[model samples]
Target: MSLRAVSMGAAYHTAGRVPGPFYRLAPVVAWTVWNLNPAWRRRLTRTMLPLCEGDRARARRAARRALQHVLEYYLDLVTLPRRDMSRFERDHLEIFHNERLDLLRSNGPVLLVSAHTGNAEMAIQALTFRGRSFVALVERLEPRDWAEYMLRLRSSAGGTFLEANFAGVRSCIEALRRGGVVGVMGDRDIQHTGVCTSFFGRRVRLPRGPWELARRTGATVIPIFSSRKRGDQFRVYVEEPFVVEESEDAERDIRAAVERYVVLLERHLRRDPGQWAVLEDFWKVHACGEG
Candidate 1:
């Protein structure tokens, strides 16, 4: 069947034990899904429409590649448990502007703000290889077993996860206070706790957790992203990091962080819209304010 047709739970629980098939057949399944999944095509194409300057044809092509990238990420993700992480880091993952990660030691409890465009997990793995443990803030995926499996793979590299909950928030705060790295995705607002912001010149609500956490903890907020350069070769880009000033105007501070993040997000998405692996319609479906 198609790649998207299989649930993560079933995939991991069954064929995941033997990832040889997953490794070889992933591209074929991704291609099949991209060609046959009309709903998926429509969703990704619409998400890329505004970005492509009205070229629906180009948007379609980008949509296909975007889906392929997402599938490749899943293939690597589901099968990563069996690989040599050290070799994976050495051969597959590379970080750009790596010196910026030094902020973790200089003035730390670094908060990495990333989007869905790239495989942020690769970035996490790269950090883990460098001996920096992280407290990654993650949204719970569906099918409890699948989520647990993912969390396990995530923790395999000497890091921990902060689930999207009050307890998780507390843990994240504690970790930051202890001068640890905490990663958060600043793109989707699954919690509905986000402040309205602009993205791709359209109004959307990105997660407030990253910026608010930084404001509260005074953590260094670094905008990072990752992309598969070829196949499994991932390049993690570390953008300029900043701190959200805890001023008397708290709302302004958070909003400013949101605005700055979106500007960079838009810039990266523009570079190669196909790297945006989000399958949902980002503008209307996920937006808080009308565009």
Candidate 2:
């Protein structure tokens, strides 16, 4: 195994074996290191300022909180395998608009679209615990071994994991066609060939795969949001499902669907800007060329 993978594996094993309270210190250390790193601090500040409307102080505070939440999220991941389901449900997981989920459950297939906010991995696990079958579309990590490790974790959550590739795309379609749920992160476009849409009054490219899949399979697209409420606690919000409009022009339909997702994403971001953990220069990336 690669050195990074080996190290990660050891860390995960250690974290799992250790008691939960011992792992709580991890977020403090990680948050301190995050603040000490100039590059990371700059990235966080740059990403947060626009979201905070140019308030430097508010941006800095939000950035610090975001990093702390990220560390807590990672700590939860390591300890997740050993967590007791009853305790997990009672202490950590909170669901809102659950009736909406029930409504979708009775329908055909569902496309659960969410972003990189809160403990998203945990959110998926919570859904699986509720007896929802999911095929999660994931981006491969840098080291192959690390990707495999994450794949194992995701699979352990009682969901099928598919990398974001052509083969994965085929599997997603098959899963949806079989009346299964397919979860996708729709905020960022790793595949550069995404459809351009307006977000926070700025043009951004969001992954069009979810929209395309919904259109092709006639699946209902539901935007889900997960946000941290407190230490190791999260609230998951399930929005009403909507069908992507079908038209003669495929491209236009995809664009419309992507824009709709962006609108939902913006609404959630407005509610908790700090929870939107985007560390890149999102606003400036494709501002000039697309849309």
TM-score to true structure, per model: 0.89, 0.91
- Position 258, candidate 1: lDDT: 91
Give the TM-score comparing model 1 with the true structure, all chains together: 0.89
Which predicted model would earn the best lDDT?
1
Off by over 4 Å in 2: 84-87, 284-291
- In angstroms, give how far residue 258 of model 2 lies from its true place: 1.6
Best by TM-score: 2
Local distance difference test scores for all models: 0.78, 0.78
Clashes of each: 0, 0
Worst 10 residues of 2 by lDDT: 282-291
lDDT of 2 by residue, 195-268 (tens): 87766666767888889999999998888889988767899888878999888999999998888778788788
